[model samples]
Target: MTSPQSRKVSEPDAVKLPREIKVLVAAAFLIAIGFGIVAPVLPQFAQSFDVSVAAAAVVVSAFAFTRLVFAPLSGWLVERMGERRTYILGILIVGASSAACAFAGNYWQLLLFRGLGGIGSTMFTVAAMGLLIRMAPPKARGRVSSLYSGSFLLGNIAGPAVGGLLAGLGMQLPFLVYAAALLLVAILVATFLPAAIPVPVHERGQAALKKNILPLREALGLPAYRAVLTSGFANGWSAFGIRMALVPLFATAALGAGPEVAGISLAVFAIGTGVALTFSGKLADTWGRKPMILSGLAVNGVAMGVLGFTGNEFWFFLVSAIAGLGSGLMGPAQQATVADVIGNDRSGGKVLATFQMSSDLGAIIGPIAAGFLVDEFSYGVAFLMATAVAAVSFLFWLPAKDPHP
Candidate 1:
């Protein structure tokens, strides 16, 4: 198999992108904004339906479940329809579903709409990534990946504050705001995005769909691809799941901080992540991916260990910052590594879809596992478990060489 670098040498035109890259990145920013607007409010909205905390969490879990199931299929759809059309359709679906979510009268209704939103998200996300990998040059891939990751982090940072403010207006107000954002996203996508020429009719009509389903073994056999998936899983597990599960509980119960204090702690952690990512992409490009991945895992391990011991609010925030920094360092490397592995193959779409599925899977599993450990033992046990997972990821990186090299 040709390496991504070698492929770049052979086909120079593959590195030269059309002007649509900016539009795709803008779509990513908009999607993140929509998601962020809902994240902080969804649980409260679910609870208004008289659901339990775990049940309310199902609102999130349902979204992940649908994304996990549909992500791979999205690749096939993008191949059949072309990237631009798929992206526009996805954003429209998300907008419509989010709008419906605002009017949902029952828990099941909300769950249904959120699941639909997840399907939309999967299509948009996979197609956008395919566009990015196809358009960016290998030399600039790291920076592009970092900027892509940062856009979402920026959205995340802004979303919660916005969501909190909107929540003050009414419980359903945030959903309305998210719907509006999605509408804007859909409009931007449709207006600014040019059509991605479909593969030749003969090429796509018979061969494309058949080629869409890359065997899991074959996909996983690619070392760089596997590494990115592993890193993505570790990231989502630690960053999204475990952090959300442990941080607030630890702040409120162990540190005796009020809700406002705990919320600020979370915000500070996200700020650290966003700030660290600003430079992390450039570092990965200059220093190479291995050091960034290994060092990030190590920092994440130490940060989790620190959280296991610290009960002070300030200390908790400090440890969270370290963990966020670790995530910032790793996230861009993981994305670039995926492109490195898949290169310019049409498989880029499927490869990224599979890679992203791992994160979704980890997001689904991490909190449940951590919550069980916490319930069975203590929050200390949960943090220790997270530390162990980080440690395992570090070990995974030890023998792993960067394929991009």
Candidate 2:
């Protein structure tokens, strides 16, 4: 078998994107930039209310908690409302909530706003995903997936560094900026994006009757979906959870660092992710999803382990970059696996929701658990635990069978 890294996607082939797809990618980049802007500061913002570490962690997980419980609802709304309306509404909701968070008077208020924002987050996320799966052409799936993910990756890379600078200006500035960006995107989406009609409504009912929305039971049985879920869980727990929630606190408590360091660390991870996405899709196509996922998991686990042991800010940045690199490597392959499972079928709303649920569940649980671990023992222990969780996710990946590969 040829190595995944050796796969060749021609330059012209890679750039051939539909007009609608470009808009979707831009929308993804805008949302990610907004979220990335807030990430490094949200934890410390919670701490401002004299909340405990666990409480601070809750601020992060609250978004995921709402996402976890409401994924089904999001999917339902997408079906009823159509992707464009749902996507717009989702953006507006988050924009309003984020603005509220920026002006929140107390810890509880901030938490409330953050939690509410998750509902909007889930709405747009699911809608965008639904669109991407159907819109991305089969021949250019690899390139399109890369671009979609890459847009967010690049936004994340820029957002954190800029957010850090903004944080220095005012802690609330990042939240406000995020709110503004989201609202602006909502306008852009409403104004410019025409609906992506994969199938006419009349035909959709017939198509829908042909296949019931893929059930969780059915999704769980597919080796590829299961593997994709496992990878998502690990990323949510380890990268989105521990790394985002715990690392800044660790930097402050252990390394005498500040917001700049925290923001830079997260930015480093985005940099690594951005770099790998440039080639990961083509690699996944040529080499197979399995090898890329395995390589990514191994690299991510090792980096997480190293991060747990290191004390210096430089080491923290280096290890965080490595973890991001790993995430980038696995991200597209796992996402492609999901698209493969769903195909061009219009009945995958529930199936996609269930797949998303795994990641949200991990994000919800990981930080809260890690925070408690930190309270019980130390930051080092919490990170090591994340590494262990990521390591175990591979077991699920092993039995997966990729259709393309």
Candidate 3:
């Protein structure tokens, strides 16, 4: 086992970080902002192609699908080439893909570029996260993770407003602007991010690969790691897919709100989530992981159920805010839980990659499954189904013990 004391001191102990970590964190923030800029415009852009609402949703699905396919490969690439090179490569891919998306002439072209962007996104996110984990001390991991998440949250909050403004200029303007931002991020990473020194390979190459890949058997062999996976899936399912699917449907069908109102409501929800995440790191460290995780799921579950039954716009926004609160609170806790379980093992990269894969898979499946229920039955049924999934995650928390350093 790797001892924390033996790990190299890559970052200073002061509140002000070393320049390299700051650059890495800024790169992450910019990448997240670039993604957020495109997110809200995607469905609208797809609709312009004369597709149905369900089909238009495929735009979002395409991105998730690419991430699902490419995230595991990201681990292998990061390990083989080192995090700095992989991270820079991913950012450039995203930038080029975003520019291509601006020039797409048809739905197929748009889908292809969006999927390509997803590939870049997966590599950049996984590599940056791994780099942060590797560089921070075990005792400071929670704080560093929180700072990383907080940067993304700020980007997420700012991106939409910027996206909305640019989108108003033209549907393609957001993509163009996003591409430029991503290009800038790539430059930042290439110029300032520290080169990641490769881990020593074992004499048996197969043994090295096996050690880097967190197999299901080995991952489950650690109960806390399993719980972290479960928590991540639940977070993605409720916090991302279900909320995005149900909120607008409920707004249109139940509350009779216009597209603008629905859009504003969604933005408000995201802002709430960003605000909650601002303090989630400190909360998780002080309060312990289990309570925060359980509380977030429970709050989100009840909010989903309430949104399913209510027809009032006021209630819709209220429930949306509650769901955002739950998600914001849970995000850092889940990351912290993974850090706690994985410790200073070189496998932190692989462990985070696996945990990210579960969330991406949930994100891919959640909307499609919820959409089926909505079409076959009602929006209420879809919301209820999400509620049940969140409820099930609570059980994973019950028997799981916290992994303290």
Candidate 4:
């Protein structure tokens, strides 16, 4: 029996998202769906050129390699061109690259085209991060990050199924479909996303816009930022690197399962992640980013540590889902922490790019290191190493200041 004013103060904002956020989320969904469409077919398409397995693998790696290499330049573009223009340009570049990939006359042509698309990928990715930071309310950054990430996750889940069906028609069809989807996203953003709102000059007469741009070195000096970088790397290592590369092989080798079972386990992991995403954002907003991030790292770490020891399918899937839950629980919080550090008024494309690089670097290195461990020692050792990496990240956060308070 609270009064209306008091009741209002206690309640959360309406569930509705801002129009700008909605547009971006929709754009994210389409972009994810398009990427998903291309993924299932890319390796197979390369193989169709009568290349060896290693060569086909190279085609897959080329995209990631280019992304890593071009990330800094993408950050520069975000600063120079403004988020809206950079985003639209990036979409068009990727769309054009996709179209080019569809019509590649040889293996090298496909490889080159795919690599070009990676440049565009980083461009849009950095711009999107900047836009989200600028537009999301300080209190609601966690929710916004979750929504943005969830759209991508859902699209990724749906994309492969559609890609698989499209493959029956032709390997190149998926690329064309993906290209068309990117075009749609570009048009949508161009039509709906407004230009940047101008900032007022500071009290001392310094240009507010210049003050808003956060330099990379300055960001690196913040303990919270440093802690976030570690978590980003660990998350990339375990979630993107190990999960994608090793899980399927582990299922087949250890559990004597088929490809179908591996697929099911992976899907279940995503299901776990989706369930966590439903509530993690709200928790991050209310409870603070630090607790959620640490908890997530611990849960994910333990789940991974035990993953290699599962004796059968039931245990395997259970741990996989648990690991996914851990990852999901932290995803929003990790993002919100970065947002907190950058604040809503400041431009942080460089900071965001560096953060992304940590993850990307981990993704590149984790599988290679884990694979070596598997070859020399065992799967147990490999997974344990992943656990160790996560632990190190947790420790890094221990002494760092929490941005929430």
Candidate 5:
């Protein structure tokens, strides 16, 4: 097949976004909504099967674990099929899996279905990010990242609140709804998202090969890429691993707050992240990426560490919001830096996938590690440990060069 237009120019020179990027953003919105619909119910649903807390937790990690294992394959597929097809297939798999989860009669069945869904999650996530870096111009890359992430966050904001209500109806109901939502998303993405224009034949062999496998050897040599790996890990550990796994429990046990309080704290965090996104992208575009990356790591480390010391709900809420804002500050810059390092290439699939893998690994490990600490020592100790992880990530940034500069 002939490559269309080949994006003959670098994104920094392009005046507007490609059609597929916009469509992908819309698809992200739909998928996030479904994820949100399931988020509030997944654990509770697992518990309903009379499983242990650890077993219930497995229902959650199984997805991330599989995603971690299969991310490389997802990168390979995106290189071969192009982002559009890969994305649609990923969504379809997730939808099918979610629907199967709704009917799962045993704990093992639920676990298996969730694991299946994780494989699909890796496919769409890596493919979509790869597509974004391929298309977004350097000057506007930050803003584009913000918009795409913002769409997902906005969906998350709406999803949990609705998911809570749906759970009240029945635990299985949310899964069915999530499945249906994903199905709809797949259909929309397939219809509206255009095929990526092929690279020129002269560049095809190398580009296609790169898409299938990552340029690990070359990427590792770049300080900027190293920094991205560091930031991705810290972000997942502090932002998601701790926040999702420990925050609610901390709110309930330490602060004496109800479930509603945890929800509010998370909402506050999301709000801060959203507000920061409004200008974070523009700042990254103008100020350079390293400064943003460094500041975000430092601020998040401070915020995370403080979580262990807070005694009241107000303080807990405030710190959570601060951490979220730190994430906001770094999110666009982090993704933009990766895009800059890859520098308009398809062979970047492996690089990007590896970058994504670092974060997913953190997300998988962070909670388990923190939970172990909490069990062995205390919540405060767990929080402090997570803080140190963030600090190490910041230090990694110290010597790293900014590709945008």
Candidate 6:
């Protein structure tokens, strides 16, 4: 007969997520869809104001810069207002900012509106992480993380194509569409989510009711958490920032491909990520978080290291897909580790926010640094920089212990 513990690891499908998580997953999908709709057009939209390419690029950077700056405050709000309220408020702010962006009269106005959206983005992002930490079953945290991320991934995959179609109507039209999507998300969460999640019978008491904020200092004491932060930054650097900024340039400059090929390569990457998400979560639970994380880093590192050297379209696409797969493998395990450390009983708003800030910081800095490297040396050098970041993260994880259930 299978032991219960063995079954828990092997048969993750038997673990059911709570209704709140389902609601959050739905919200994640909508948010990703909205964000994706704006992403492809935002730079072009800025260029419409007769700005230089560098100036237009700054508009994109402004949003991430703000997110990194406002992250600590977002964490404080999550602690003060609770996750549901903070989430709703955050989305509402983003929705309103998107509307403002749609009607902006000039470059500065558009920049201001876009930057404001980042404040709300971080607010909700941190709160959502808080919610996941508190609500996910310890045993099923990886599965829960996978479901939420997968929803976002699907929405992201679908949104850009739709956004491309919507852009034909008018550039501003996509902004309006994204705003409407966010409004719908705000309404859905406001109507369906509970004010307070009920704790288990054993946990319910005065002790549970009190706020138990996990200080950033305390969280940093854990070697695994430190590794998580390192990996988060690396992931942001390579996957979030560098991938978006460098991939198209590399496709065109290195492979002698057209713009369409760049788009296809990105799509292929996302599809590869989707494929890995299908099974990685269950494996993270069964095989352990450390192994999954290290494996992901190694795979992503090597794939990226070799990306610049791919001489043909086929090889480039294959490497891109593999990098995406590595990224997908890391997501659930890294998130579940954070959840494990924080646990359901404690508030980790600051800790979660700091972790988020690490990623945001990477997203902001990675491209700028890699861009310099690319300009000075070559695409191969930039990609190698990414590989180095991943290797450093792997080293961080080496001594860290895996989380226990």
The lowest-lDDT stretch of 10 consecutive residues in candidate 5 is 6-15
Candidate 1: which pairs clash? Answer: none
Clashes of 5: 3
What residue pairs are clashing in model 4? none
Sort by TM-score, best first: what order? 6, 4, 5, 1, 3, 2
Give the TM-score comparing model 6 with the true structure, all chains together: 0.96
Which residue pairs collide, candidate 6? none
Which digits, one per residue and each the tens of the lDDT, describe model 3 over residues 183-255?
Answer: 8998887777656432222222543434353444565688778887887887788777776666777788767
Candidate 1 lDDT over residue span 215-330, tens digit each: 45676787666666777788788888778777887788888888877778777778778877888777776677778887777787678767867967778888888888888888
Error of 5 at 309 (Å): 0.4
Residue-pair clashes per candidate: 0, 1, 0, 0, 3, 0
Which residue pairs does candidate 2 place in steric collision?
Answer: 4-287
User: Which prediction has the highest TM-score against the true structure?
Assistant: 6
lDDT of each: 0.76, 0.80, 0.75, 0.87, 0.84, 0.88
TM-score of each: 0.88, 0.84, 0.86, 0.95, 0.90, 0.96
- Look at candidate 5 and tell me the lDDT of residue 199: 38
Error of 2 at 31 (Å): 1.8
Per-residue lDDT of model 2, residues 35-68, tens digit only: 8899879999999999999899788878988988
TM-score of 5: 0.90
Candidate 3 Cα deviation (angstroms), residue 113: 1.6
Clashing pairs in 5: 11-137, 210-347, 214-350
Arrange candidates, best lDDT first: 6, 4, 5, 2, 1, 3
- The positional error of residue 222 in candidate 2, measured at the CA in angstroms, is 0.7
Candidate 6 ranges with C-alpha deviation above 4 Å: 1-10, 200-209
lDDT of 4: 0.87
Residue-level lDDT for 396 in candidate 6: 97
